[model samples]
Each structure stands twice: as structure tokens, then as C-alpha cells.
Target: MKNWLLHILVNAIAIIIVSFVFSSVEIEGFIGALIAALILSILNAIVRPILVILTLPITVLTLGLFLLVVNAITLAMTDALLGSTFEIAGFGMTIIAALVISLLNLVLNSFIKD
Candidate 1:
């Protein structure tokens, strides 16, 4: 339970960092970031696995580069679900933000365990 809250907080921080780095990724405020983080985490868990599995052939063909696209799609899905609060402008920016968010979450989570 503690770990889960930490994960959400880390995600919110990652979202803020990504928003600062990328002009296209706009997080409205702290609450918006929280909502976006939760939505993104849920989408990643529920949708990313299915996408990874369904695109296994292409993922293999691309030597795993396609996973980045999968990640971007999840971020985009979060944006779509959240409406104007979390606006991820384009696919390019979405992809960039997703990559940065993933890295931030990984590094932050590593040191932020329960």
C-alpha cells in the first residue's frame, strides 16, 4: 500500500518533469498531474501488456524499438481520457515525453521504495 502511493507520487513528479522539458506536454496543476499519473499508470498496466503482446512480431522486427511507440500510445491514451487537463500535443512530443517519464519513474522508483 505504501509502495503504491509512492509509485503514484513518483509518476506525478515524472509528469511534472516531462511537462517542463517538453512544451507539448502540458500538466495543468498538481491535481491534474495526480489524475494524469493515475490514469497513465492504469492504462500502462491494463493496455500496455496487450499492446506489447499483439505487436510482438513488429516489436521483434524492429529489434524492440516499437516498444517506445507502445509507451507513447499509453501516454496518449491517458491524455485522451483526461481531456484538456493533460494535453500531450503530438505523436512526436508524446513519444519524447513518454520516454522521459519512463526513465524518471524508473530512477525515482528505485530510490523511493517502501
Candidate 2:
């Protein structure tokens, strides 16, 4: 339970960091970041797996590079669901933001233990 909350906070921080990197990825504030992060986490867990399986052939063909597209899809889904709170400008921006957020999350999560 504690770990879960910490994970969410880490994701929120990652979102905030990513927002700073790209002007197109606009997070209203910390609360917006938290909301976006939570939605992103939910989508990543529920939607990302299905996408990974569906795109497994291409994923293998690309040597896992396609997972970045999967991540971007999930990020776009989160933006759609959040309405105005979190806004990613376009598909190109989504892909870039997803990449940065994924990298940030990877680095942040490494510090936390299960």
C-alpha cells in the first residue's frame, strides 16, 4: 500500500519533469500532474498489456522499439480521459513525452523497493 502511493508520487514527479521538457505537454500544476500520473498508471496496467500482446509480432520485429509506441498510445489515452487538466499537443508530442516519462519513471522506480 505504501509502495503503491509512493509509486504514484514518483510517476507524478516524472510527469512534472516531462512537462518541463516540452511546452506542448502541459500539466496544470502538481495536482494535475498527480491526476495525469494516476490515470497513466491505470491505463498502462490495463491497456498497455493488451497492446503489447496485440503488437507482439511487430515488437519482436523491431527489437522492442515498438513498445515506445505502445507507451505513447497509453499516454494519449490518458490525455483523452483527462480532458483539460493534462494536455499533450499532438501525436508527435505524445510520442516524445511518452519516451521521456517512461525513462523518468524507470529511473525513479529503480530507487524504490517492493
Candidate 3:
């Protein structure tokens, strides 16, 4: 449970950083980032797997690169859920934001022990 909370904090930080890096990605504030992070984590857990399974063929065909699109989809979903608080300019920007967030999470998560 503590680890999960830590992950959420990490994700929130990532989201905040991404917002700063990309003008197209907008996060209202720390609280908004936290909420977006929680929504993203939930969507990744609940919706991502289903999407992965459903898109296995394409995922395999693209040598797993299609997973990035799946990631973007979740980001878009999060943006939709949060409305104005978390806004992504467009699908293209969302894909780039997703990649940035994934890389940020990878780096951030590495500092913590699971």
C-alpha cells in the first residue's frame, strides 16, 4: 500500500514535469497532477491490460511499438476524465506526452525499491 502511494507520487511528479516540458500538455497544479496521476494509474491497471490483449496482434506486428499508442490512448482518457484540469492539445501531442511520461516514470521508479 505504501509502495502504491509512492508510485502515485512519482507519477504525479512525472506529470508535472511533462507539463513543464511540453506546452501542449497542461496540468493545473500539484493537486491536479496528483488526481491525474491517480486516474492514469487506475486506467493503466484496469484499461491498459484489456487494450494490450485486444491489440496483441498489432502490438506484435509493430514489434511492440504500438504499446506507445496504447499509452497515448490512456493519457487521452485521463485528459477526458479530468476535463480542463488536465488538457492534452491533440493526439499527436498526447503520444509524445505519453512517451515522455513513460520515460520519466522509468527513470523515477528506478530510484525507489519495489
Best by TM-score: 3
Write down the TM-score of every candidate. 0.95, 0.95, 0.98
State the lDDT of candidate 3 residue by residue for 18-103, as single tens digits: 99999999999999999999999999999999999999999999999999999999999999999999999999999999999999
The runs of at least 3 residues in candidate 2 whose Cα sits more than 4 Å from the true structure, single-residue gaps closed, are: none
lDDT of each: 0.91, 0.92, 0.97
lDDT of 3 at 107: 97
lDDT (10s digit) by residue, model 2, range 14-108 = 99998888889988999999998889889987989999999999999999999999999999999999999999999989999999988898999
Better candidate number, 1 or 3, judged by TM-score: 3
Q: Model 2: which residue pairs collide?
A: none
Query: Backbone clashes in each candidate structure, one number apiece?
Result: 0, 0, 0
